[model samples]
Structures are given as structure tokens and as C-alpha cells.
Target: MFRFEDNKCYRMPAHFGGFDCPGPEAALYYKDAVSVTFTYTTDEKQLASYVPEGFELLRPELNISYSQFREIDWMAGGAYNLVQVSVPARFNGKRDQLEGQFILVVWENKTWPILGGREETGIPKIYADIEDLHTIQPNYYTSASYEGNTFLRLELLGAKPVNGQLLSEMQASAATINALGWRYIPKVGAPGADLSQPILYPQGAEVHSAWAGSGTVKWTQLSWEQNPGQWHIIKALAELPMLEMAPVIMAKGVIILKPNNGRVLE
Candidate 1:
């Protein structure tokens, strides 16, 4: 027999067939990552509906990133790729106090990470075909596609060691943003349930090494079944002006993610 509660299943001992957990371990630790951040202009009102209460849109710029992770703790130390789309927002209308970016969509190659990220952090993560290729020595390239439509592409031109001043500034910005948590809409199991409550995860990354470089980015519309909840995101992206073809911040480094016990901030 099985019982469903709080979006999780509880099976009776009699029904247990001596099977281990169906998902990965409680946490995943990434070893190394190479990433590029691209900033684009968009209409602020289009994103307003997605922004939760007590948070305000900080800028019209949207940040999209492509990252490749190696030596992940799970999957027997295998590698995977990830793509994220986010927007900057301020909390409590405080201009000086900038909160972390609100992630609109995240795509990964692995299933375990996608499941964990969606359930734990309320991240809108999905599994897709991700390709990470190295054409020339020290030059990395990546792309993500779904239903035969490629939606994202990235290329890292080159990377070099960072100076002390740049490293200090990066560290300071990381510290300041680390205090903020991500706000997202939770998946409801029952119909007519209270969907107004937002889920918040107190998570941030600690940058171990920072590199400076240049790169390129491109985005296209993804073809997928759109639910009512996803219409806002689709419309928002459509309203954005042409994104800059080049990345503003191209970095290759490693970081330790700090994802605390998640909770609802209602």
C-alpha cells in the first residue's frame, strides 16, 4: 500500500521490495565549472507578474548562463551541463539591498539533479539534450536543445587569471548577494489549493576561483507544451529586445554551492 502526502509517497514496509531510494543522495557537490553570463535588455512590466510580493524588478537586464560541471559527487563522478535564465530583482523596494536573481528556467542533462533542484529549491528545471564540445584547445562550446529546436548556444573564447582588484570586487559582490534567497512558485498536488504561497530557498554559491574572459551567447524559442503557469515566462521572453550576441561576463571557475534546508517564506 502507498500513501501520498505533501507531494511525496510513503510506502508501507510490507510493500517494500528491498529497494533503495529512487533518487540521488540528499546533496550534490560540484567539482569544477566553466560558465558564461550574458545580459540582455527586456521590458520590465513583462516580468512584473512573475516577481513575488516584497520584491521589485531591479533592472531590465536579463542574465542567461551556460555552465558545464565536472566531477559531480553523484552519478559516479560523471559530468553534466546546465543552462539558466534569470532576472535581477530587489527585495522590499530597497534599492541598495539587492536580492539574488530570480531563476525563470533551468535546463540540465541529468535527471537526478533536475528532480532534486525542482523539488528542493523550487527551481523550474527540466531535462534536455545538452551538448558540451571543445572545438579547439582551451575553447569550450555548449548548446541545449529540446524537440529538435536549439534554444541556447555558448562559446568561451579564452580565459586568464584574475587580478587582485577584480577578485576582491567579485568576492564582495558574491558576499552581498549570498544573503538573499530565491523565491519561486511551488507545485501544487491538489486542485483549488492555495497557489499564492511562494517557496523560498536559502541557497548561494561560494566562488573558489574566478577567471576573466570573453564569450558569445544566442537564444531561440523553445518548442514545448506550455501550461498556464508558463505563459508568463514565455510572454516575458517574447517581449525582450534583441539580446546582445556577446557575453558581458565570461568566467571559468569552481564553486561550492550552499543550499540550506528549504522552507516556505509565506
Candidate 2:
């Protein structure tokens, strides 16, 4: 007979074995993280349709980011890359009201982080082959693809270092780093879910340098033949109308991922 224990972490093949749960102080450290991010206003109604219930769209803005991560602690100094799509939203839960960037979709180059992130912290992570950052002095570029078919590309042009006072002001005006996601696990041979809820995953960053630049994002409409499982996702995002574009930012920083500290929203 098998019995589940309390205060323990489990994943697939749980009946076979178990591992030590990391403490609250545990963090996955990221070194030499370079990220290119840009935000743009889109159609309010269309964006709202994608957001789950109990969430209020803070604005019409949508953000797209591509990052290169190296020297990871949990992977024993391994490296990977990722791309993210998110929107500003406020969750109106029964016991709490919180504001954060609600992740629409995230694609990672490796499988380890994807599985752990989705199962434990509720990040909507998927797989993509993200290329290393391509730089030509003042310009930086990267792309994401599935099965050798490129689906998205990101670039920052004319990037220049931010001055002391401006960087301070930008940091001061930044909002809290509370990331939101929806966790859903379907029951085997059933139409309903075994578990479904919203999650609050908090994280922090220690920035070493920052740059302001003209950022550009290009999303390719994927076909079933190109990306069978994720064609729709790419198509939908590619259809989002870009109403207004904001300045693109390139930042170098150390990212702190707190998987143990993540919690379910009430």
C-alpha cells in the first residue's frame, strides 16, 4: 500500500521515490543574465479574452522578452535561454487582491526547468530552442523556434548604458515582482481537472547594468505542420495588434528564483 505524506514535494513517478524539499531560503541563482524586453499596447477587449476570470486587466499593454541565462546554480553551472509573453493584471481573489505580470506563455530551451516550473510553481512553461544572444556592439538579437521552424524574434537596437540617476528612477518606479500563473492538471481519462487554481510566484533580481534601446518583436504565424501542439498559441499572439510601442530595455542582472516560496492564491 502507498500513502502520501504531509509537507512533502512530489512529481511524476512519485511512487518510485522522493527527494528532499528545499527550504524557503533556497534559491536558483542565475548569473550573467541578459534580457531584452519591450512592452506595447494592444486591443483591450482581445487581451481580456485571454485572461482568466477573477483577473482585471490593468492596461492594454503586453510585454515580450527574450533572455540568455548562464552559470546556473541548480544545474551545476549550466546554461539555458528563454522567451516570455506577459500582461499586467490584478487578481481579485477572495482573500487577497494582488497585482503582477500574468504570464501568457513562456518557452525554455531545457526540459528540467520547464517540468519543475510547471509542476511546482505553476509557470506556464513550454519548450523552444532559444538561440544565444547575438550582439553587434550596439545591437542585440535572439530568436525562438520549434523543430527548426522559427516562430519569434526579438531585437534591441542602439542600446546604450543608462546613467546613474535615470537607472535609480527606473528602479524606484518599478512595481512589485509578483508573477501570476494558472495551474491546471487534468485527471486521467476524465474531462475535469484533478487540480486547478491560481498561483503566486514571487522572484527578485539584482541588476548590474541596464540599457535603453529601440526594441522590435516579430511573431510568426505558426502552422500545424510547423508547430502542431503550439500553432494556435503562436497564431493568436501574432494577431495581437500593436497599438503603441514603448522603449525597449536591455538589462544585465542576477535572477533569484524562489520555487519553495511560491504559494497558491486564495
Candidate 3:
């Protein structure tokens, strides 16, 4: 149970579950977001092992992004930062249409967003220290690190506004690129039940945003440690040969968490 008194709210143990947790307690908005996309080639067989049976790898491309928020609803929201890694993929053997980029991992500095995202969408959200600091005019630098190990470093030079045509294209792409996740349900021991086959649910999210831009992207991956069980595939990606890096596509946007209505493949 929860109670609001004297302009403050308190949460009890009973108020848990049922999507009744306190908050978004705050809303977030960002004006300037720096994102960098890195496209690299990897072994097809290795890539295929990570996803579901029918899902297909669209391309050997990987995108890593870093952004610092300009506005946050909370009082202590001082330049919150985020870093994410994703790969372009298609679902159900549909090579003609891009299902969207599947998020491999995500790191952020805040707690509420991470908790909410993990619970709702099954996105692997972890806590880390991310900094987007400005050392020189017209040039911004960013880095993401965890437990004294720096994994990502980037430098954006000569930031500028995106063109109208490119911005519109980006918005359209953002709308179509839904967030995908893998949900697992273990089998229960019941009478005459099929215990060998577990349940898997493919989840998706509605993505909506109106802002995007581009800049010269100079990025480097310092380390890729296998800290969690689900993210062990990152080690294989780190072993792949370094291919050309794509121009950074930056966007300040919002991701709407909708109920899981996506197709469930048995």
C-alpha cells in the first residue's frame, strides 16, 4: 500500500507488482543527445546462436550510443547519462523488412528507469558511470565505465543540427524500430504436462521520437567483459575483426512501454 501525506508519498510492501510501483516519479527530456553507430562484421553462425530459432540477422552491423539528458524531472537529475549496444536484425525470416535493432545491453546512471525497463520489457539494464563532458568548444567527449574498467570512449567533433529531410527520415525510422526482447518461462511439474518444452515470449515496444542529428564519430571499445550471464555473447563480438565505423546517428527521444502484444513463437 501507498499513502500520500504532506506532499510526500510512501510505498509499502503490499503495493508491489500489478504495475503499481511508484513513479515514473519523474519525466525526462533531452535536447542534445550524442549517439554513435559502429558497423562490424561477425561470423554468421555465431550470431545466429544468440537469437531465437526463426529470427534472422539482417546485417553484421552493431550500434553503440552514448547520450546525456538535458532535462530530468527529479531534483537531483544532473546530466543523467546512458549507453546502449544493439544489432540490426529481422524476425520470422523476413529479410525484406527490418524488424528493428535488438538491444544487446544497456547501461545507465539512474535507478528508476533501469528497474522499470528491466521489469516491463526485459531489456538488460545495468548501472554504470557515464560522462559526457565538454573539454573544448564545439567538441564533446563521452565515456562509459563500470567497476574501474572503461568499456567505451567517444569524441564528437563539430556538432551541428540535422537537416529537415534527414530529420524526417530519422523520425520515421525511429517510429518503426521497435524494441525487441526475449522472455522465458520455465516449465512447471504438473500431471500429464510437457516438461521438455519451455515457454518463450517475444516482446516489443513502441518507439516514438522527433529529434535526431549527426556528427563525426571517433569511437573506441576498450574492454568487453562478460559480467552477466545473458551478455556472454558480447565476448564473441569483441573478437571480430574491426570493420569501418558508420557516422554517428544521435537522437533525443522517448520510448513508450506498451503491454506485450507481440507474436509468441512456440
Using lDDT as the yardstick, the better of models 1 and 2 is 2
How do the residues 1-266 of candidate 1 rate in per-residue lDDT, one tens digit apiece?
A: 64334544333342443334334324345667666666766666766666667667787777777777888776678888888887786555433344567676777888878876765556778766788756573566778776555666766666566668877676666542322334344457755533343444444344556655566666565434523334444445656775444434544455455444444443
After superposition, the stretches of candidate 1 with alpha carbons farther than 4 Å from their true spots are: 1-28, 93-98, 133-139, 158-161, 175-196, 206-215, 222-239, 243-247
Consecutive 10-residue window with the lowest summed lDDT within model 2 = 168-177
The TM-score obtained by model 2 is: 0.95
TM-scores of the candidates are: 0.71, 0.95, 0.64
Which scores higher on TM-score, 2 or 3?
Answer: 2
How much does each candidate deviate from the true structure in C-alpha RMSD?
A: 5.6, 1.6, 7.5
TM-score of candidate 3 against the unseen true structure: 0.64
Best by TM-score: 2
Q: What ordering of candidates by TM-score runs from best to worst?
A: 2, 1, 3
Which residue pairs clash within candidate 1?
Answer: none
Choose the strongest candidate by lDDT.
Answer: 2
